[model samples]
Target chain A: MKNFFVIIVLCLFISLQAFAGLHVVTTTTELAAIATEMGGVHAEVKSLIKGSQDPHYIEPKPSYASILNKADLFIAMGLSLEIGWVPSLLTQSRNAKIQRGHEGFIEPYQGIRILEIPSGVVDRSGGDIHPEGNPHYLMDPRNGVIVAKNIAQKMAELDPAHGDSYQKNYEIFAETMNHKIGEWQRVLSKHRGLKVVTHHQTFSYFADWLGVRVLDRIENKPGIPPSPGHMVDLIKLIKKESVPLVLLENYYDPKPSQKLAGETGVKVLTLPVSVNGVETVTTYAGLFDYIVTQIVGAQ
Target chain B: MFTARLMVVLFCLCLLFSPTLVLAKKKIPDQSSEGQVLLWKFNQTGNKALIPDISLIGIVSGAYFRDDPATVQWPNPTRTGFNLQAAELGIQSVVDPYIRADVFIHMLEDGLEVEEAFITTLTLPLNLQIRAGKFRARLGRENTQHLDQKHFADYSRLRRYFLGNEGLTDLGAELSVLLPVSWFSELSFDFMQGRNDVSFDSPRKQDFLYVGHWANSFNLTTNLTMQVGVSGAFGNNVTVRKLTQIYAGDLYLRWRPHERRGFKWETEYYYRSLEGAVATAKEGGVTTSMVYQFARRFEAGARFDAIGFPEDAFSQYQVSPILTFVATEFFRLRGQYNFLHTDGAGKKQHEAFLQLMFNMGPHGAHSF
Candidate 1:
C-alpha cells in the first residue's frame, strides 16, 4: 500500500509537470496552425482532427477528452462546425476552465462575416446544413487574418505574462498575410468571375474571397452525394456557362469530378483546403499558395 | 410498488410534455427561418428556453429460431416472425451552466417504462462529475449502454446470465473522478437501492448496492487505442443475512486509421458469488467480439459468449455473426445469426434476426 501511494504521488507530480506552458487544443488543423503562429513558444498547440480527415464526421473518441482535460485553451471554428462531436468532448473533459462560456473556450466566428445562413425552414432535407452559417471560413485568407487576431487576443488574455509577445506575433502574421493575400489576388485576377464546379460547398468562402463564380456543386445538397439527375443538370449547366475548372478538395474522392471533367473537357484542380493537407502545404499561408498554383496551372 | 411505478411514469410524462405546452403560448413568426426564429422567440420569452432536444428511436426486428419459444430470452425475438422490439423517447437538455438532464422513456409492447432519468453535474471541481436519480451502473463496458448503442442486436449470454434481463440499472447516485494521469483514467462509485430481484433484493432500507469501477485507456499509437477496466458490485441478497458479490473486467482495442475505416475488438468477463444460508454459489462467464468497418457505411462483426467452466454441470456457449449497414447517421439495418449449445440440456439452437432502427431529432453526440 505504501508503494502504491508513493507511485500515485509520483504520477500526479509528473502529470502536473507536463503542462510547462499554456496548452492549446483546436478542433481542426487550420486553427492549430494559426494558434501556433500566435502562441510563438508561449503556448503548446495540438489539433484534434488532421487536415486529411473531414471535419464533419469526427467521432468523439475518449482520447480526445483526455487531451481536452489538460487544455488551458480550446479553440474551434464555431457556427456548429463541430456540432456533431465537440460538445460531448467538452462535457466529458471535466475541465472547468474550458467549458462553454468560459475564457479558456474560444469560438473565433464573432468577427467573421458569415455566409449561407438559411432564410427558410431548415432541416436535414438540406443534407446536414449548418443553420448558423458556413463553417469553412478559414479557407478565405482574410478570415484567416481575423481568426489569427482573435486567437492572439484570447491567448494573451489567458497568458497575460506573454501578452506583448503574442501581440507582436499577431502583427507580424497580419502583415505577412495581408501581403500574401494581395499577391494571391493579383495572380488570380484574370480568373475573376470565373465559373467553376466543385465537389462540395467547402470552397464557398474561397470563391467568395477571389471573385470567382461557382456555377454549381457536384453534390446536389451540402453533404449528399450527387444523383444521376443532378449530374445531368450539372453537365448542362457547365456546358451552358462554359465552366473552365472543376475544383475538388484533396480529401474527397475524385471519381465524380473526373467524370464531370470527362463530360465537359474542363480542367480539374484537386486542391488542399487545409494546412498540412498535402506534404508541401504545411503552413496556413502555403495552403492558399497551393490552391492558387493549382488553379493557375489548370488554367 | 404499482403506485410508485405509476408516480414515476406520471413525473416523466409531465417532463416530456411541459416543453410543448410552454412553447405553444409563444407564436413563431412566419417569415423568419426555423433556426433564427427559435432563437428569437427564446430571447423574447425571457428565461424560457424550454425546448429541449427531443428524439425518438424505434427498433423492429424479424427473427427465425429453431428452438423452443419458451426458452428464448425476453429481449431477443422469441417468435419466428416480426417483432416490435422497443421504441425509446429521449429528452435531454442543459438545465444550467452546472447541470445537464437526460431522460429516456422506453415503450415496449407490454407496457411503458422510464428506462433512465438522471442529472449530471458539469462544474464539479477536481475533475469530478456526479450523476443523481435512476441510471445504469457503469459496472461493465456494455451494461450501461442502451440497446441501440450496442454493436450487436441482442445482449450477450454472459450479461444476461450474470446481470439479469435489464442489467444493473436502478435508482442510484454515481460519482466519477477523472484521475490525474497522463492517459485517460476514470474512477467511479455508485450507490443504489438494492432492488434488482435476480442479484440483490432486501427489504431493509439500510441494505444498498455499492459498485466501484476503474477504467484506463491508452493511445498506443496515432491509429490505435486500448482501454482496460475492472469493476465490482456488492449488495445484500434476499435471504436473511446473505450477500451477493459480482466482479467484472473489460478490454477494448480499436485501430481507426481514418473516419471511414476501422477495427475494434472488445471482451468482457464477469464473475458472481451469491451467498445463501447454507452455501455459496460461484459462477463466471466471458463475452468477446470483433467488428471491422470494411466500407464507408458497412460493418461486419462476430461475437462469442460462454457462461461456465468446462467442469460445471450447467454450461452454455453461443456464437454470433453479424452484418450491419448504416444508411445514414440516423438509420441502420443489421442482420445477425446466433448458434447456441447447452451442455446440461444437451440441446442445440439456431436463430437468425434482421433488425431495423431509425432515429430523428437534433444530432446527439455519443460516448466513445
Candidate 2:
C-alpha cells in the first residue's frame, strides 16, 4: 500500500512538470512569430492583434486581458505603438509579474536603433505622431535579430532550466536572418536608391535598409486619409521625380494608390508588413520574401 | 507670502525640467544631430516632465424641441437653444509602482463638480485589485462609464429613472478579482455610501449600499466578441425603514474587422424593488442600442429605451437615432434625434441635438 501511494505521488509530480512551460503574450503577430521561434518548445506564445489588423488602434478587448492574465512574459513593440490599448489591458490583467518595469515585461525597442524621433514641440497636427520614435523598426531585418535576442534573453531569465535551449535558438535565428539579409540585399542591388512613393511612414526602416528613397507619401500626414488636393500635388511630384512605384501596406485602403497608379502609370505594390498578414506569408522570413518579390516584380 | 508661493512653484518647475536638461547635455549625437538640437529647443521651451497627464474635454450642443416640455432631465438640454453642456478636466498618473490615480472634474452650469476621484492598486495577490475613494460603481455597462464614452448625446431615460440622473456614482471602495478561466471573467464588489435619493437614502452609518457584479467575455469568432454581466445592489430606504434592492443585466457584442470599421450592439435591463410602509413597489426597464462604423470616420447608431416592464405601473418609451463624424482622435461631431412618449400624460415630444466635443492631451486608454 505504501509503495502504491508513493508511485501515485511521483506520477502527479511528473505530470505537473510536463505542463509547466512559460506562456508568452505579445501585442503584434510579428513579435509572436519571433517569440515562438526563440522560445521554441519551452513556451506557448500568442498575439493580441492579428497580422491583418492595425496595431495603432486596437480596441482593448476583455478576452485579451484573460490571455494576458496568464502570461509569464509580455512583450510589445513599444514606442507607443500600442499606447491606445495595451496599457489598460495590462492593468486589467491583474498579473503583477508582467506589469511595466518588471523582468517578465519586455519592450524590444530598447536595444534597436529607433527612427523618426521627432524634434521640438510635437502635437496632433502631424496626425498621430509617435513621440518616442517609429515603432516599425522590425521592418529592418537587423532589428529583428536584436528583438529575437532580447526575447530569448528574457525567456531564459524567466525559465532558467531552458536557458541553453533559448540561447541556441536565438543563435540559429540570428545566423539565418543575417544570411537572408545578404541574399535580399544582393537581389535588390540593382534597385538601390530607387525612388518610391509610400502610403504611410511605416516603411521608413525598410526603405533605409534597402537604399530606397521615399519621395513623398500619399497621405500628407501620418494616419490621415489622402485628400484630393494632396493627391494632385503628389501626382505632380511623382511625375517630376520619375517615381516608378507606390508601396502600400495591405491593411490600408488601396483606392488612393490605385488612383495614383491610374494617373501616373506607376506600379502599386501592396504588401503585408507583419507575419501571417496574408495566407502565404506565415513566417518572419516569408513576410520579407513576399515584400521583396513584390517590389522586384513591380520593377 | 504670494511671492513665496510663486517661488515654490518655480522651484518645483525647475526640479521637473532639470532631468531633461541633464539628459540632453549628456546625450551623444550619433547619426542625427538634428534630434539633439530639437531636444535642446524643447527644453528651452520649459516643457515640464514630472507633472501628471492633464486633458480638457469640452462639449457644446444645440438643441431644438417640439412641444417643449416644462423641464427636461439633468444634463439634457432643457431650453431649445445652444448650451455649453460640460467641460471636463481629467488628471491621471501612476503614483508609484503599486498604485495609480485618476481625477475628473466637470464644470457644469451650476459649478465645478468632482465626478470621479479614485486610486487603483496595480499589484495584489490572488489576482485581486482594490480601488478606493469616490467612483462610479460597476453596476452595469453604462453606469460605470463617463458621458464622453457613451454613443448617445444624452443619458438613457431608463438610467435616469432608476439610478438617478448621475447614475450609480458615490464615495465607495471596490474589490475586484479576475477569475482563472478559459475566457475573460471578473467578479467585483463595492461598498458605497447610500446617498442617491432616487433609489437609496439612509441616515444610519451602517446602512451602506452593497453591490456585486460578475462580468464575462467570450470571443465568438475571430472578428466577433461578446460580453455579458449581471449585477445586484442592496441598501436601506431609511424613509420607510425598509430595504431596497436593484438587479441588472447587460450584454455587449462587437464585431471589429479592423481599426477602420466595426459594429457594436449593447443592451441593458434593470429591475428595482422598493419596500414601502404600505407595500412593495417593483419597477423595471430595458435599453438596447446598435452602432455601426460603416466608414473610417463616420458611424451611425440607434437606441430604444422602455420603462415600466413586468409590472405596468408606468409607461415611457424613447427612440433615438444618432450619427457621428470623427474628424480625428481629438475631435468629434455628432447629431441625434429623439422621439419620446409617456402614457400618464399621453404626451409625445421630439427633440434634436447637434453636439461638438474635442479633447487635448495624452490619450487615455479605456477598458474593454
- Candidate 2: residue pairs that collide: none
Interface RMSD values, listed in order for every candidate: 7.3, 8.3
lDDT by residue for model 2 (B1-368), tens: 34334434644554354332343355344435331111111111234655788898888899998876475555656668887777889998777656788899988887898888999876666677778889998888889877788888888988988887788889977878887667788999887887888888877776788889999999999999999999999888766578999999999999999867899999999999988877888999999999999988999999999998866478899999999999888889999999998887655889999999998887477777
Docking class of 2: acceptable
Off by over 4 Å in 2: A1-18, B1-49, B67-74
Tell me the whole-model lDDT of each prediction, alpha carbons only: 0.83, 0.84
Candidate 2, B15: how far from true, in Å?
Answer: 33
What tens digits encode model 2's per-residue C-alpha lDDT throughout A1-299? 99999997676433222346999999999999999999998999999989988898889999899888888899988887897898788889877778775557878764577889888989988888888778899999999998888788778777889999999999999999999999999999999999999998889999999999999998778889888999999999889989999998989888899999999998898889999899998889888999999888878
Q: Fraction of true contacts reproduced, model 2?
A: 0.48
Off by over 4 Å in 1: A1-12, A16-21, A228-244, A258-267, B1-50, B71-75, B310-313
Considering the two chains of model 1, state its CAPRI-style docking category. acceptable
Query: Clashing pairs in model 1?
Result: none
Q: What value does the lDDT take at residue A230 in candidate 2?
A: 97
User: Which residue window of length 10 is worst by lDDT in model 1 chain A?
Assistant: A11-20
DockQ of each: 0.32, 0.29
